[model samples]
Target: MFTGIVEELGSVVAVEDRGLDARVRVRGPLVTSDAHLGDSIAVDGVCLTVAELPGDGTFAADVMPESLRRTALGALRAGVPVNLERALAVGGRYGGHVVQGHVDGVGTILRRTPGERWDEVEIGLPATLARYVAEKGAIAVSGVSLTVTHVSDDAFGVSLIPTTLAHTTLGGLVVGDAVNLEVDVLAKYAERLLGAVAR
Candidate 1:
């Protein structure tokens, strides 16, 4: 599991395809500093296992077909910046909400409104995932945990502070850019239990 707190802004160094599967190598000096094989890392809100530590401040992970189909990681190529976070340790400070790194769906940046202190980004919400989002709720966008500022039937908004703009890849987002979205896991669990009880 992860906390949706981006540890480093890593770049994709290489992507090698092996028929139905592919291997991705990302350069993350901080996250790979003490990394070993088989460790879990969240890459753009997708949990991927570290298949190899290449000993060059980079680690490689194999992306299965399912992960490629579900998240934005499949469209990634060399030089794309991705949010990287190591798996949460037991005693680490939980600054963000619980993040399973399981992306619910992909959303597109519809527009961006710049403010004096922050920016409001509106993302096109997928119909199937709309029920999981709520105003003032937590959502992971490309692995960065953010609070929803507003929600409409087809879209939702998030406010990005100065720190977030400077530190994460979100600042570079443009209109029509695709992003990974992960709704709060707690919300999903609650819905599941409620449905079971109703039945």
Candidate 2:
């Protein structure tokens, strides 16, 4: 589990395809400082196990085909930046929100409206995941925890401040760019519980 708080902005150093899976080597000195083999790292909101820790500020992990199909990691190329976060330690502060580091689906940036101090980014929401999103709710986009500013039937908007724009890869997002989306896990659990009670 993670808190959706980005520890570092890492760069993809290399991607080696191995038929059904790919080995991704990411350069994130901060996150890899005390990393060990088998540790979990959140890459662009996808929880990936550390396959090898070289102790050289670089870590390699395997990305299965299923993960690629569900998230934007499959289309990643060398030099691309990604949000990196270490797994939450026991009794650690939940700075952002409860993030499983599991990407539910992918969304696309539809438009961006710049404000004096922040920017409002509107993204298209997948129909299947729409029910999980709500205004003023927590949503993880490309591993960054953001609050929903508005929600329509098929899309939602998030306002990004300067700090977010400078620290994460979201600031570089353009129109039509694909992003991984993870809705609040609590909301999903509450919905399930309510459904069970109703039944």
Candidate 3:
């Protein structure tokens, strides 16, 4: 589990394709400082187990074919900045909402409207995931937890403050950039429970 709190902005060092899976090396000094082999880390909101600690402030993780197909990790290449976060420790402060690092779908950046201190970014929400999103509800875009400012049948908007704009990879995203989306897990649970009750 993660809190959607970004620990550091890391960059991809290398992505070695191994047919079905790609071994990705990411350089995150802070997250790799106390990291260990097999430790879980959230890279741009995708939970990946550390396969190797390369001892150069970088960790290697295998991006499976499923992960690549579901998230934007497949598009990662050298020099790509990624939001990095260590898994939440026991009794750790919950800075953001519950984030499983399990992306439900991939969304495309539809448009961006710059404001004085923030920018409103509209993402093309997938139809299957649209029902799980609500205005003012929490959503994780590429591992950065954000509150939904606006919602429609096919899209949603999130505001990036100055801090977020300067910190996360969202600031660099363009109109066609793909982003991983994880809706509020609690909402999914509620829907499941209500469905059981109705039946």
CA lDDT, every prediction?
0.93, 0.93, 0.94
Using lDDT as the measure, which candidate wins? 3
Q: In candidate 1, what are the lDDT values of residues 112-192, reduced to their tens digit? A: 999998999999978988888999999999999999999988889999999889889999999999999999999999999
What is the lDDT for 87 in model 3? 95
Ranked by TM-score, top first: 1, 3, 2
Better of 2 and 3 by lDDT: 3
Displacement of the residue 9 alpha carbon in candidate 2, Å: 0.4
How displaced is residue 37 in candidate 1, in Å?
0.6
Q: List the residue pairs that clash in candidate 2.
A: none
Show where candidate 2 strays beyond 4 Å: none
lDDT of 3: 0.94
Listed in order, each prediction's TM-score against the native is 0.98, 0.97, 0.97
